[model samples]
Target chain A: MDVRHLSLPELREVIRRGQYTGPTPGLAPGYAQANVVILPQKYAFDFLLFCFRNPKPCPLLDVTDVGSPVPRMVAPEADLRTDVPRYRIWENGVLKAEVTDIRDYWRDDLVGFLLGCSFTFEAALLEAGIPVRHIEEGCNVPMFVTNRPCTPAGVFHGPMVVSMRPIPQEQVVRAVQVTSRFPAVHGAPVHIGDPEALGIRDLAKPDFGDPVTIRPGEVPVFWACGVTPQAVAMSAKPEFMITHAPGHMFITDPKDEELAVL
Target chain B: MDVRHLSLPELREVIRRGQYTGPTPGLAPGYAQANVVILPQKYAFDFLLFCFRNPKPCPLLDVTDVGSPVPRMVAPEADLRTDVPRYRIWENGVLKAEVTDIRDYWRDDLVGFLLGCSFTFEAALLEAGIPVRHIEEGCNVPMFVTNRPCTPAGVFHGPMVVSMRPIPQEQVVRAVQVTSRFPAVHGAPVHIGDPEALGIRDLAKPDFGDPVTIRPGEVPVFWACGVTPQAVAMSAKPEFMITHAPGHMFITDPKDEELAVL
Candidate 1:
């Protein structure tokens, strides 16, 4: 079955029913997919502020009301506890369990945040004829922790983490133009060339995800990665945290075009 | 004294000392003046979501940590509790007091938010040779409550409020081009012509602020007003609310040019 042809509700239903248990890349093609973060109400304010301060890495899509499982704005009918393909439960900043649903661990104080994911912008890049190295290599995009510190908000503070793509030197301008259109999803390149400038020592050894080939004519372009917020949240070592494991994203009803500003 | 000549720190010190008690208009020229809203932390999450939902009316510039008096991003050294020239205190949705400073009423649970004001974009308009009718008339800008309902978040929900200026039909495109550059400050006009289309029965009698004249050839242009969030916050009738009194904004360290995107 082609998941791209399925509607948002249908796609979410499949995930909810445990029929789909895989990374959501290329699923529900035109719909927006989000990075998920769930924290107790006590930490909601700081996390929200963290997203606001570091918009490039944490462009907030929608935040569920405290104790509520439904995301009123983004996906009214979907349940945050059961809608995603996979969930990672973190206890005191350490990953404790991976599950298909978090219903057993649901708490009244939990506040869910849906952040804009780069998958939306990757689709935009492909449409604009810019090559995405990770897509070509059939692997996760390379992500590295940079020396740049994110603007701190309360307990959340950490260095910025960025995802890298190797773009031909000639098409760097086009890559920036295409990604700029999607500010909600890690818009524009943070650094177009020179990985060392951001304090990344080795391109071949990424902190997360698989490293893609960097051709001689290609320049390594880096974008503020969605992982920064989750990483920061983890560093704070909150009593509890919940997230969609890696690329197993939460799909929303909003179309990818809905996020475009111009 | 020419307020434009004064440095940001100097201007803030004057305002803090209560020596400068006038409206912030044309004061601190080239610096960004912000619409202030200080609310109890209990209602902060809802209000933050409200601003995020309605970016046009409430383009959030900076938000302080709970119980903190400093606006760390926009005006790090300025004290939010007393830096503004005047403040309006509300209790149960009723105006309780209008004071020069809010230091006496500051609480540990309070959170300060600095929202972008239209003054920055207005300055851009004037620089582009487009005449702002209200500035020309030497009176407050006319504001109206439109029939359009804002996307609500939690307890904060209300109709969008808009400020109007009469522009010659020939310069409408230029007005849009100039204003679009300052998305942080209300961005482009929501409606360009025909007041009746927005359910605005009479242009002369505004819902808030002073009314400006609409000349024979000029069109009534409406942009989302900064008052929407404050009005929405007031409508929720929280136990407490604080805001800048009309034109008495909180001047920030950010320059007018910094808010422009291009």
Candidate 2:
């Protein structure tokens, strides 16, 4: 099956039936893929406020109507329960299950939030001749927990997590220029060259994801990661929550260009 | 006193003390002024969602803690009750009173919202050499209600209200380019050239504010106005509401450049 040529809806429909469950790095090439966060109706206001307060870490793309699995703005007909390739169920902040669909766990009070992911900007960077080490190394991007505390909202507060890439000394400015266009995603690098300033003690070992090799002329650049909200959720220990499993995101109809500034 | 050279807190202090009641056009010079909206907690979520849905019309800058009267993020020391030069009170969609302070009406459940005002972009436009007709005419910008309905959120639903400015044909592109930088304020032109496209019947007679002269070679450019939330609040007619009267706005500490995307 030549999935590369398939349309967005066609690709999602295939995932909904439990036939496909894997990383969605290159699928649906030009469309935006979003990080998913669903919480009970009681927590909706705080979660939404949290995203508003910290736009860099959590750039909200679309929010589903309360109790409705459909994200009307991003994907009107797509069902959140089944359309996503994989979902992680969390109970009181503990990961309880990793499954293909959350139909059985669905409740009427759940509110889903789709946040912008980094895939769009990474593509732009690659197109501009900047090398992405994770994609080249065939490993997950190196992620670390920073000491910088996110501006807290009601019942949600924690330090930020950042993804690191070693950019060549000269391409650092170009990398910043490229990523700054997509503030809907993680935006530009939060820290460059100095890990200790972010309370990161080691570059070789990250708290999450695999660490990539740093070439001779490269300097470490860090960006606010999407894992921030999840880490905050874990710390808060909300009664119930659901999220898209790592790299298995929800694809939206809007193109990456729609989110760009220039 | 030279109010233009006065600091933000000092200007706000003057307003708080009832020493100033005039429109704040050039006051506090480079600082961002905000459109104030105070609604009961019962309506905050839907109202915020409404703002989220219609970003151009209602670009939110800061939201105060419920009943706090303190906008922590924007100006930690500024008090909402007395900082704005003038305020309009509405009860069940009807204009009730105009007040300098609302200490008597203060409620434990009220939520104050600070929305981006066009002063930020207008400053940018003037700096970029684009002539703003209303400013040149020394009159309030003309505003019209459109046939297009805003994406409704709960009980808040109404047509978009746009503020019009006649721009020279040569400067239209520059106007768009200049304003596009400040998305926190009403970003870019929603419509240009034809008023009929937005269902605006006559340019001379606006639903709100004074009409300006459109030169022979000028095109009528419309922007999503900050008046939208006020119009919608009137339509929804909740138990009680409060807003800054016409041209009297609350000023924030951040400069015009702080709100810019680039």
Candidate 3:
């Protein structure tokens, strides 16, 4: 099925029916896609603080009211439990099951947080005529667990994770300008060049997503990735947590243009 | 005393020693002044979320680790309990005391949040040759509680409060441009003209702070004030809260230019 042609509600309904369980990179082209993180009421405070303290890595999009599956701000009518294309069930920070829907695991005291994803910014980059190597190569954007540790909050503490993209030397400044407007989605480049600076050994092999080729004269530009909190969630080992499966993001009604500032 | 020449540490030390307990507008000319909010760990999450959801009204600068007296990020050596010129002690959301020091009320479970104050942006406005009537008339900036309710988070909910500055019709665009660079502060104006649109009846009679003269050929520009979350705190009525009193603020080491974006 060609999901790219569907509207926001149509796409969500398709995912809700379990008819589409795929990554959401190219779907709903201009709309914002979010990283999902749901935790028990006990860990909600610490986790929420975690996002506030580390905004570049965890730019928040919308948060659900306590025990409510609805993301009241981003997509109120949408049911988070079943709308996302796929869900990851983690027990004590260990991924135990990947489910098509999380209705069975829904709890009375869970708080849902939806964070801004880089897809919105990536679209901006592509529109500005800047090449997104991963999109060009049809691969996941390369992600690395940086040595830079995130500021800890309560029980949540871990190193920051960053996603890297290659851009020609002339386009680096343009890339920064385009992304700077979208601070809600990993803003500007954390590091412009040199993987060794971030403690990454090889550009060809990423710790998380698939790496793309860096063409001649192209430098790897690092942007704070939404995946940092997920990694932290696993390392901190909360008793229970739920996250969107890799690349299966929760789509929101807000357009990419709305996320831009200035 | 010529307090204007004092460095950040020096100014803070003088404030801590109780030698200075007055408004901090012109004291540290280039440094950033912050709105202080101290809450019990239980209410910290809701308050932080309130700031995140309403960025214009509550642009957070630094949030300390839970139960800590130090603002680790902004000022590590600075003790939040006594660093500000004055503090307001609240019980069940009602102001019970305004003191220079909060040592008697300091608790182990309190979390300190430093919110970016408008001083940074106002300084920028003046540097750009845009007039700020309050400063010209030697009074407090006029503030109004608008009809727009902040995006409620947890138990915290209240209308947004805005500080108004009348700018020449020609300089209104310049005012927005200058403040836009400082998103870390309250950023750009939320409402430009027509006080009644925000449900504010008399622009001359403000809900808080003293009103200033609006000369001819000028339109009142309203920016989301940092005072907002404080209003929310009182109305939300958490069990205990501490904040900076009136114009007294926490001055930070970072310069005004450092808070600018892009």
**What does the i-RMS of model 2 come to?**
1.2
Better TM-score candidate (1, 2): 2
TM-score of 3: 0.97
- TM-score of the second chain, cand. 2: 0.96
Q: List, residue by residue over A38-98, the lDDT tens digit for candidate 2.
A: 9997888777878888888888888877788988888888999998999999999899999
The TM-scores, one per candidate, come to: 0.94, 0.96, 0.97
Model 2 global lDDT (CA atoms, 0 to 1): 0.89
lDDT of each: 0.91, 0.89, 0.91
By lDDT: ranked, best first? 1, 3, 2
Task: Mark the 10 consecutive residues where model 1 chain B has the least summed lDDT.
Answer: B1-10
Q: Is candidate 1 or candidate 2 better by lDDT?
A: 1
RMSD of each: 2.0, 1.6, 1.3
Each prediction's DockQ against the real complex: 0.59, 0.53, 0.74
Ranking by TM-score: 3, 2, 1
| Tens digit per residue, CA lDDT, model 3, B43-144 | 887888788889999999999887788887778799998899899999998889999999999988999989999989999999999988998998889999
